[model samples]
Target: MANNSDIKRRDFVKTAGAVGAAAAAAARIQGAPAIQKVKAANNQVQYGMIGTGGRGQYLLRHLNSIDGGRCLAVCDIYRPNLEAAIKTSKDKPKGYLDYRELLARTDIDAVLIAVPLYLHFPITRDALLAGKHVFCEKSLVFKPEEVHALRALASSRPKQVLQVGLQRRYSKFYQTAKQMIEKGMLGNVTHVYAQWHRNPGWRMRQSPDPKRQREWNWRLFREFSGGLTAELASHQIDVATWMFGAEPEFVVGVGSLDTMKDGRDVYDNIQLIFNYPGGRKLMYSAISTNKHLSLFQGTRTEFGEVIMGTEGTIEITVGTDDEPAIGLWFYEPGPPKVEKAAGVKEKPVIAGATLATTGRGQIGLPILFERDLVTGKESFLARELKYARLWLYKRGIMVPEEDRNPVDVELDEFFQCCRTGARPKADLQVGLADSTAVILSNLAMDEGRRVYFSEIEKMGRTPEAKGRKA
Candidate 1:
């Protein structure tokens, strides 16, 4: 018998081979649309960036590669952030201290917002009212009222695009996963387990100036942040809800501020279970003490999700700045079917070779190809080639990857939508639903109760409801 270490080594080699082959094969794939360059003036969307903080700067780095949009203006309350944005950009953009000033420009057709959680609503609302298309970062709104408010505002501005910065929605790997789920590839996904464990947690920096301190450590305070839920868990929870194809009915959870004591009120650790329709559940955990992820056999860390079904399981995660997103599937093994002789009684055998013959751990199948690529419409040669590649993929000779990073794809799509008035994949409705989950999930932990997602319908009706926070 092979040792576990030896088996793992073999599995690793196969996985590596499959990934490399798939990546190489994807480049030469026929029938794929040619990559178009965004050099024409009519093809480009004029945009401004607001709140050029860490997240904002991160987006700017990605924006460097994208040409479909041009940054006409940059805004940040902090002078350094504004300067950094100006320096990072290829096109010279006017700098503003107030975001409203940036929004006032008529030349700017859209805005990319990467502000703190609390400011997400006010900024987005203001930008929409300014008649510019908006692409705001994730956990779209800060509070319940914002959810209702933004929805109403976005509905009124049907001409303008409002896209949320949930890059996974634009990822090919994720889209393929969604298609697989729809096609029963995973066989009735019943449960999803997600975790985002980070070491050291959010930095607790205190400035001599009170306002600066608050601005610097907004993530640590409960008033401005939803802690781990809004920052990390929201992404994974959205993935769960998306893959399940339904909203969660209710959520129950607990949160604790035990680990890092730095005068911050938000919890350092959290665990929640979302009960969706059809008896499906999404179990989640976020902790500050560790950064180890159990998915992909500990190959990746910090964040990932496990989708479990009757026939198989899928472990998936989106790409970071350094790592590309990956998805792997493992099929469940059942007892072998045996045919009995007609009218003959089966007897128990004293000696059994079943244990010796049975396979140990199952090898993971890469969730790679698009449904249409291997479907009925393609030419026989194309279909044959796809199947042959699939055969290689299953044998761990090739694994698939997206042609471009999701972040870049998302930004480019946002720009295109802004110009063409096309609806985005991660539009306002999806953003609002994700925000509602974040708000209610935090409330579930805070109030020590199982909170229904439907509560958001009536949540912001009154002043008291409007002021509710995590």
Candidate 2:
């Protein structure tokens, strides 16, 4: 037999589920664009891959399933990576030792760049100069001069599509979170806490040829890499900027090479605080010590973000292959209203002073997706399946999932933009802004001072200015 508590819990679940479904339905009614598929061979965007290393191969793996883009050529300085990229792509792309040789081919319409940080600008510039549309991975440029140069180059080629590899912009859950913020669901979002903590990060790899060791371990050196800021914090920093609807005004941070004393020049741990317009803040931390995450009841680890507001809070993170993306919402309870004492004319007396003194813990609610929402038009079986899934979700047995991975979505969108001349969500400007943050962040830590975003205008202007401290 069901007890009163069990009956009340079921009722609350039903009500909350209905509310979530209604929200989804409202979003649908507002005309959210459906995912598009490209099937025609002629309509496909013919593209080439440059720098077929780990990131390049990862993109190729996702690109294999994306019908909108077809890979024609792949290039890498290293022969093994080129071969691996060709094997990863279903299209059997032609492999090249020189990216220039691949770019010289007029048949290729666009190019995907996943080279190391130091090489990102030169290859992207060459590819653009070759009249190919470009999709470059994030921390788009290495130095401040590259930032100015790439912006100028991209602006000159107005017809060409230049997309950055920030996949979160393509995520549906992220989009929904933005909508919730706009709707004041998380009222007046003021602070965001983000972290990417890894245990024993970036092990050194031995190269067969001694000469290529530096090339293999480029990320460990400050000469080639911006280290943790460019590689890890860049993603979450973009998230904070996106959610805040403004760029950061200034940033101050501390970085240290405390662990992994194996000739690596970059910092192993970093903690930063960024101040945006309207006094909003984003606190970030990335460490090489542990992989524990406090969000989602410690069920996940490594990376996640917490957005806090006056009325509510949201804990969100992008998904991995083994786990789905999670967005947990918590509502802050309003303080109890003071009641006037019987027949008293003075200011309202506190109704139970003890009740108002204690903190009320909030229960987290799952942010529902489109599939979790039920329309009246669903078939009997479909509706029942949805209900069962909702029940499981409420019971913490299952979580909501995206219809497609954001990587595939971003790749498909890039191809679509190439074909249609549409602008990408993560365009050149977005990439530049992210890169600027990375550059300034490193400057702040190295110089031990607050670095202003406006300082980028003065940086890398003249040859001598590049070496000047902020």
Candidate 3:
């Protein structure tokens, strides 16, 4: 059904995609060594999980696949969650009501803290004091003081592995995107747009015991959570910061408790703009009314980021269980070049004329993975099969997937870091910066003004402010 020219064009595009994928793979390999899996039981990093709530159980599900870490205990005040966590662990870990009791165990070489935002600091501090490595979920600290305190404490214990649960750092697709940025594929990136939208987001679950309702729905309260900013936006903010290679100078935002008024103090919808250095900006939005995502041709929803630049744009999002992480590259057309007379200097073209000649919107190309890279080491049949798969991917017949989930990869890396005494990719500083963004963004919304990032140095430092909430 296809003409020879059409087949040749398809082959050319496929080959080009393959080359780009190989370059990305090579770049990532150059940045860091390949993750080595530990199979020996004697080398397993003994760890304890604190929290065992929904997030804790989710991590446990991923941890079950990683053999480098052995969960020795799980702690939670709620009996059901503790039991659920114990059941989830392949190691049949001991259950504890008090996280400190679990931290007290000399056998626990590391602690994975998945408690609510408020408890993250206290538990992490305790775990560090107990001489156990810690992997805490993000929006790493609750308040500004905790940010400084945790940084100081983690610095004091440099030998211990302190990783934040910002899993995009471990994602291959994200790594490739970063590599692309570094390689000048996306020239002079100046703006990023990100969103995590949901229709009727985060409903309050009724507890059998009415007294425990507030405690259970911690995310809905200002006391226990930073709301959507910490829970959702923190992740994307980290992505923007990572891409930009710097933190924002100032943040301005508006938030409202508009729709879901079930006694929750946190906002149901928020829109924010983070002004980074060099005139760059990250515009963000998280709404509860709509789940539409403008990324990936709207094939997906809920969350994604768009990085815009002079030469190209990247639309990306980390994958979930049902979907593979996707990164799409759209190349921007440069202004048409005018030929000058021989040995004559040419004047700059007018902006209006240049704008008219600049080309139309481009069809996006898939930012390929290592699997898509053709190293030319494969057998004849292997090469053919790889080509077939690439064709299928380009035709939307199939999607390219990461060899492992980023969540699983991050957890595995945490355990590996624990064993090797290596610094995690999402180290203490990265977590602290993310937390600072959360604190300032909330402050910006609460005060209804642009909040400068530098104010964090003096904030929560005074003795009087220690007792007060920011």
Clashes of each: 4, 0, 0
User: Runs in model 1 with CA error above 4 Å?
Assistant: 1-40, 206-211, 338-359, 371-398, 463-470
Model 2 regions lying over 4 Å from their true place: 1-40, 342-356, 374-389, 463-470
Clashing residue pairs in candidate 3 are: none
- Candidates' TM-scores? 0.83, 0.85, 0.85
Name the lDDT value of residue 136 in candidate 1.
93
Q: Which stretches of candidate 3 lie over 4 Å from their true place?
A: 1-40, 338-359, 374-388, 463-470
Give the per-residue lDDT of model 1 (tens digit) for 313-411. 888888877787788988886668999889998777757766787778766778775642677788888888888888887786766777899999999
Clashing pairs in 2: none
Tens-place lDDT per residue, model 3, 328-401, is 89888787787778999777877679667555776678888766777899899888998998888777777777
C-alpha local distance difference test of each model: 0.81, 0.84, 0.85
Error of 3 at 329 (Å): 0.7
Question: How well does candidate 2 match the true structure, expressed as C-alpha RMSD?
Answer: 15.9
In candidate 1, position 50 carries an lDDT of 87
Residue-by-residue lDDT tens digits, candidate 2, 112-208: 9998888788777766666788999998999988898788777877888899999889888888888889989888999999999999889788976
Which window of 10 residues has the lowest lDDT sum in candidate 1?
1-10
- Clash count for candidate 2 is 0
